[model samples]
Target: MEEKKSKFPKWLKISLIVIFVVGLFIGWKAYQTFMGASVTDKEEYLYINSGDSYEQVFAKIKSLDIVKHPNLFDYAAKAMDYKDIKPGRYKLTPGMNNRRLIGNLRGGYQEAVKFRFENIRLKESFAGLLGKNFEADSTAFSAILNSEEIAKQYGFTKDNFFSMFIPNTYEIYWNTSPDKMMARFHDEYTKFWNAERTEKAKALDMTTQQVSILASIVKGEALHVDEMPAIAGLYINRLRKGMLLQADPTVIFANNDFEIRRVLNRHLTIDNPYNTYRYKGLPPGPIMMPSIAAIDAVLNYQHHNYIYMCAKDDFSGYHAFATNVAEHQVNARKFQKALTDRNIMK
Candidate 1:
């Protein structure tokens, strides 16, 4: 063996030793880049906008100042051929290594936003909320929502297109398109109106939209969930008798004056289709995005002869119901006096 080793030159031996040391150093660095924690303390987010170049993505990552050893990340990114940056809202957790971070960016593994909306009364307001939660702008969303042709495609008119949006929390991607979002809503609305719910609506001699309309009135009438069924029943009784729904909330909605504390005689004269006091049946659409509880209340409304409701005089968020005009007048007088005492004269 000594004789064989003698054939090796000193330079060759030195070269081998140097190469071994360099290899060890390179291996250690690679391990640190791929396995060691790179993200700083606390969670962070990286928003790679659409059409962003790799350089732009790197700039954003650097601007966040969350990554430790950014050069190492760059090296590893290049080594893994992660040259393409996908657009998304990526969540970077603490203790995330460069490999995992790059993997997320390359794969476009975005975080879903918890988009929620309820009690949205106007189409513009609903569009604004959707814009805030998604990539679509308010203008674009509103235009699409107001398009008669688009509404007809979904089996709705522009005025009633808002009924398709069942108010609830939705896990939505940040970059969902407007049309895609509407389609999802359509699917959700269909799923919500199942065979059982459809049969219930038919039993009550109401369409799905009609039920939603009544639910909206009930929602606007009372804030207390426990009283929703009673309110719904009162409206149903009124509907059955061919009497005016006379829902005060509908008058307020028709006047477009949400600030009105009292629906005075002046507000009632407004010629709007939403005015249930004037219109013989349900409005063209829901006055507001009715809650699921309100919708269910309409479906399971308590059978009663009550055709009238007035806000209670005690300031509790409950209503006084009556079957006769005389009893309703007494309840209304009490409420009017309370309103007068508070100086809520308009």
Candidate 2:
């Protein structure tokens, strides 16, 4: 069989060769447009706000001065058809290509923030912490938290509404709405209180809210993890015996002064529901966002005869426990003398 003959016209052959070369060049350019390294070698994050237009996102990318990519993403976006950019905090790696970067945005594959809180004593502080880790600011969160309607929506009153947020590390998106954020916390709180935990709360004849309140006190008094159960037990004993809680932390909380190291007589005289020194039962709410360990400590409090706690005289975080007024007075005297020697007078 004879091979096919070339076209007779020389000009036609030359034109065909030129077209083939141009097509190859175009293909190579397209490949580099999508796959070549375009972003700058910098550790930064790109924040895409909700409801942002494509133009706004493009402008935001440019504002970062990001890329070897001054004008390339337009072509990349068109070629890859990456419209509807998802809102989030997207991490820009050291050196990323347009395809990898835009693909992540298109799929809404944003980094989940590690949200957490500890020793959070007020709604203001909690809101502030959320503001730091989310697209929503403190004001937005505070508005939601301060709303009595929102609190009721979560099955809590405004006064005790803060108990819905449990302290733990949570994985959440940065752009979650304020209401959704509350829902998420509520979900976590519910999951944390399982059947076993509910049974334990019933066994002790205490509500979960009451447990959280006592946990906050236990957390306030005990500096070391080992002492949590003992302190919890002492408080439980007081509650069972109908004695005044007289917790120094509650006195500090009633004064709304976290700076008070020594609970003076004047401080205890504050007229507040949170003042366990004046009130005969548990405080109306938790004085702080208690830790999980603290909560569990109350659930599994050590059974004992102790009903009093006085901090040790050595400026150590540890405390001395006593079962009687006389013993407590002796411990209190030693701690008071140590405080006086150290000039910690109120």
Candidate 3:
């Protein structure tokens, strides 16, 4: 090595030094481009909508203000041949480098969103909720919900279409379509009404829809889950005895005035079919979307001689049950007195 150095010219030594410097610079640049901190925050999200172009997706990423070196990201993305940007909700976590972020986008590794609905009282409200969660708008969802022809394809009428949806939290992509959402609900409804549940409904002499209808009433009556079965039994007894359901929730629904804290004698006179006090049988449909617990309560209703239920006067969200008119009237009077004392006259 000493002999070679002796033979080497000064220019050659300078050239070698220059080459080493250039190589080091190139290596550093490559490292920065490939493994640098791209996501500047602990977490970020990117929503690429349907039919979004690559430029549009890049714009959305820029708008998030999470990218530390957007130019490097652009160069890396182009070099990796990432032309197609999949539409979905993408979550970018901390310590993600440029290469990792690009890989996630190129591979369409999106995060699923939680979609949940319970105690939804109106089809319109349910539609709005679904629209907010997915790409479909409220009008689009409402159209499908109101269409008898479309509902019939799933073995449901427009009036009873709500029965097809079971209340639960579902993990789904944010871009799910309305039609797909409806199909999913139908599949879930079919799976929920399995042999065991169906057999139980049969024993009760009720159809799946009938169970849902009664479940809605039970849910409206009972604020406490423990009382659901008792409320279901009371309603069942009333149904069997050819008595009016006399459910105040149904009366409130019929009036379309949820603000009426006290269901007065005037509210019961509403001519809407949802008023159980006026209607002989179950309402034209469920006044509200019933939960799985409420539905099961109807299927496994407690056997008892109690044919009446009045909300407890203590306002403890419990009810008092009675076997006859005298006891029921006494319970009703106590509750009425409590309401009057509170000056909740409506």
**Candidate achieving the largest TM-score:** 3
Q: Give the per-residue lDDT digits (tens) of candidate 2, residues 25-136.
A: 9988877788888777554788888999889888878877776765888789877887887999888886688899899889999998888788898889999999998999
What would the per-residue lDDT of candidate 3 be over residues 1-346, giving only the tens digit for each residue?
Answer: 5545567789999999999999999988888888877787834677789899999878866777667777888888898898987888888876678899889888989888888889899999998988887876899999999999998999878888888899998888888888887888888899999999999999989889989999998998888999899999989999999999999888988899888888888887878888888889899788899989999999999999998888899999999999999999999999999999999898
Off by over 4 Å in 3: 1-6
Give candidate 1's error at residue 224 in angstroms: 1.2
Give each prediction's root-mean-square deviation over alpha carbons. Answer: 3.4, 3.8, 2.3
For model 1, residues 92-152, the per-residue Cα lDDT tens digits are 8988999998888888899988888898888999889887777778998999989999999
* Runs of candidate 2 exceeding 4 Å displacement: 1-28
Best by lDDT: 2
TM-score of 1: 0.90
Taking all chains together, each candidate's TM-score versus the true structure is 0.90, 0.91, 0.94
Local distance difference test, each candidate: 0.87, 0.89, 0.88
Clashes found in each candidate (C-alpha, N, C closer than 3 A): 0, 0, 0
Clashing pairs in 3: none
